[model samples]
Target: MRKRVLDVAEESFQARGYHASSLGDLMMAAGITGGALHHHFPTKKALAMAVIEERVAAAVEQTWIAPLLAAASAREGVRSVFEAVAAELERQGFVRGCPLNNLAHELALADPDFRIALSGIFSTWRQALADKIASDQQAGVEQGTDPQRFAALAVAAYSGAMSMAKTAQDASILRDCLAALKPV
Candidate 1:
């Protein structure tokens, strides 16, 4: 029941934009009625918070962190993670863009707390990648670059590149941009 609301909310927020999406619309989409929706989420902002938390956690674990952990070593993991990001962008046909980045652009400044929450998610993700990069170098699996800066740049590049790609509706442009990245 709770998951249903979160899922519906995530999709709604993603598609409709938080400001544009109404509780009335969400209610109809979710097949949820009145006080029942309020019982689970007292306010639309609370529901947005849940959506942000869940989506960030899922993306962090599945997209960056998981790949970083699963590969033969830290370097392979980090490389695979970026590759996965590219693959995902390509798989989306360069149309979907990024879920977190999209929301941050749309709602972050308009809502201060939402911006902070989104900022935290990005920070956590970058730090996690940085740690992996450091570990890889320390473990001698790979040797090169300042892990922290590299991680930050890599994450930034992925987000910015995806946003641009989404704007152009060009997957190859994203691929070209990603290919230009080297630890610098």
Candidate 2:
């Protein structure tokens, strides 16, 4: 039941901003009563926190961090991730944008806790990419870039591209941005 609530809430918050997803609507979507919902999450904020900490963080880890870590080079990893996302978005025929970015845009300024949690995810993402880039540099697979700076730029570029893609409702913007970055 707790997992169900979190899953539903994560999807809901991603689809609709946290402020717009009322408790009643969430409850109905989750098919849980007030008592059951409150038993796992004392408040709507608590539920949102859980979704941020658990669902959102896990999504980032699986989608970005793990794949990058497993790739042969940071450049290849980032390019592959962007290509994969663009392909998936094209296949899905909808641009919902990056989940973490969506939440950050909506909630980062709304609450300190949300900001902290979202910042942590972004930091973790950047750190992972930086580490990969550093490793690649040592192996002579990459050169002429600071890992940390490149990682930050990559994150910012992806976030901005995703936002633009969402607004334009076109995944090609992502491929275009990736080409513009010429990421290394």
Candidate 3:
């Protein structure tokens, strides 16, 4: 039941802004009656927070951390993550912005907790990438690629490119951005 609620909330949260979404809609989407929803989550806001927490961790691990850990070279691993993003943009037709970033922007003004949580998640991601870059630098001495700066720039570029691609409905733009990133 918890999984169902979270899954349904994720779908709604991804499809519509959190402010525009309601408990009734979430329950309906989950195929649960009113009581069933309350049994799992007393309030829609609480459920949203849970969804944010779970989604943030999952997104971070799958999109960035995993790739960074998997490659023989941390640098190549970081590169792979960006490449994966470009591939996803192409796969999705570039119509949807990242769910996490979208939710952050929407919930920032409405919910301070949500904003804080989202910022923390992003900070973790940035730190992970920066650490990986630093690791690569220590092993290979790749000068001109300041680990912290590279990590920050890469994420900013990725998010900005994704935003633009989503706005234009052109996934190719994401690929173009990835291609422009220095091969580190």
Candidate 2 C-alpha lDDT tens digits along 1-184: 9999998899888888799999999999899999999999999999999999998899889888888998888888888789889999999999988989999999999999999999999999999999998899899877888999989988998999899999999999889866875644
User: CA lDDT, every prediction?
Assistant: 0.76, 0.90, 0.77
lDDT of 1 by residue, 64-112 (tens): 7777766766545655655666676667664666778888899888888
Instruction: Name the best candidate (by TM-score).
Output: 2
Worst 10 residues of 2 by lDDT: 175-184
Q: Which of candidates 1 and 3 is the stronger one according to lDDT?
A: 3
- Candidates ranked, most accurate by TM-score first: 2, 3, 1
Give candidate 1 regions above 4 Å deviation: 73-75, 89-94, 141-144, 181-184
Q: By descending lDDT, how would the candidates be arranged?
A: 2, 3, 1
Which lDDT value does model 1 have at 26?
87
Q: Which ten residues in a row have the lowest lDDT in candidate 1?
A: 175-184
C-alpha TM-score for every candidate? 0.87, 0.96, 0.91
Q: Largest lDDT belongs to which candidate?
A: 2
Error of 1 at 155 (Å): 0.7
In angstroms, the error of model 3 at 123 is: 0.8
Give candidate 1's TM-score: 0.87
Per-residue lDDT of model 3, residues 125-152, tens digit only? 7888888777777787566577778778
